[model samples]
Target: MPDQAPVRSSALPVSDWQQALDTVLQTPVKARPYSAQIMRQSPTAFLFLIDQSGSMDERTTYRGRVLSKAAAVAQIVNQTLLELALRCQKGDEVRHYYDIALIGYGGLNDEQAVSLWSGAAVGKFFLTPAELAGATLRVDEVTVERNIRGRAVTVTEKRPVWLNAVHNYRTPMKSAICLAESLVGQWLATQQGNDVYPPTVINITDGVATDATADELLACCDRLKALRSMDGNVLLMNIHVSDERGNSILFPARADDLGTDQYARLLYDMSSEMPTPYHADIASLFGLDQRTSYVGMCSNADMDALVKFMNIGTPTQHNHSFTANLSSEP
Candidate 1:
């Protein structure tokens, strides 16, 4: 038989295309978001919206060592990217199971939100695991104490540095979120009918957005969360880091729990509701009551809490299954 040409949307009649779209729009979404398994063919995404405002220059402590908030955040973000890249490694090959983007706001005097990837990945909005690993600017040896056989000892480990400490100008958070929404919408357009897990946007900041009011920022967040894939709507997780030494709110179920702190409550309202799948992990990690609902926002988090919060926001529980599948593949 002669080869038949594939049908293109532009070639279809208006009514036909509209009917097809309506069918897809009416189709029921399967399960909740974040439940889909991340595979090479059906991958997921993570967009880190970092605040590079002048307040980030304040000092903070991590692992008993004092550093600027921007420095600490860069460490946490670099470590997370390293872990993610490692998870996709199968012997000599790295699988492209996830697309990652990093946006740093207020890093320049112009108050623009821009991609933070340096070296070979500069100006790129999204990068696969292999591309990210190859785009390292340089490697640094970090000293840390570890407990081995019940004895604590100092050790040095080599860490890749993808992002540098950037602190300048005021926080243009609204612009950052808007940029993320645009990038995520473009990404989902490529995914189309694929049953991929929804993207997660983790916004880390030390202060309020200077470009927009609280209500305005929340409206931008709502638009970002509205972008979705076949799996579910996108997740917007916010983390407010502070240098103050005191009790921090990790995740609150209700606005009442946030008390009179308008900034904290604003972040809480801007955050997405924690999905049920993550409730168990949050409960086990933070000892929260599993029954209570939680928002994906953290207020006044120190360096330690920031690390843990980032882990929960990034989805990597499927690494074991992904590895198994890789082994079975010839």
Candidate 2:
């Protein structure tokens, strides 16, 4: 037989070795994708999937006081929305930098997973920053400490309450993840050609899925990450609110960091990898070194870590000027 030309790995016909080399070199390298910034002109969405199962009713100590997981989640969601709204605030109006969703799983009256907002907001999946500000059911005051002149000082601030604490019978986590996927898909469709940031889905649960098996939950997570826009795919974050007391795990690079807990490892696998720019913020805010691989997940998170996780997930580069309202010791 006569000598034949070289063939590429794909078995494509090539005249010579150079042509095969060219074909190999022509293979495109995919860029490492990252999360997009939420802006006014091109806004992003935030879908909060909360587990309101009966297990959430189990009380746990947070900040010297005991509160149920349901209570913690409600406070965290409301506070996070408030912070996002503040970030979008310019002059007197709230910029539409984000569209927010609050989906609660395992409710008695509601189905498996449904929008927990009341009145006209029940059927709505996404709410603008302004709409979120107005959707609050009530406002209550809470006291927090701030470091002033190297001393902790108490301060009182008005806190808005949106979703109330609810402890239901079963945890329909599969339904919650499915709802999140649907909402994320719809949001991505709206930003088809735009350079808008991809939506972020954060699921705060007790690490127990009563409605579906482990495989089904993982499938739902895969579906969520598959939804994308021009900027990037949806970022899925999970917070396992364990009632067990001890050191809480934040942003673990390996499954070993999560100990031998299978559920925690599962959540770690199902989470989005932390983006580059977010590393600094995570390290600075939560003191977690993200130079290494760490997915957006926290297992058995305490109240402080839970709040920090929320702040880390929704970030703004804008710096605001503030005037002192209190008298200084100096």
TM-score top scorer: 1
Model 1 deviation from the true structure expressed as Cα RMSD, one decimal place: 7.6
Q: Extract clashing residue pairs from model 1.
A: none
- Candidate 1 structure quality by residue, lDDT tens digits, 166-229: 8889999998898887777666656657877788899999998999988898899998887776
Q: Can you give the lDDT of residue 26 in candidate 1?
A: 51
Alpha-carbon TM-score of each model against the true structure: 0.86, 0.80
RMSD in Å for all candidates: 7.6, 14.0
Model-by-model lDDT, in order? 0.79, 0.71
Q: In angstroms, give how far residue 6 of model 1 lies from its true place.
A: 35
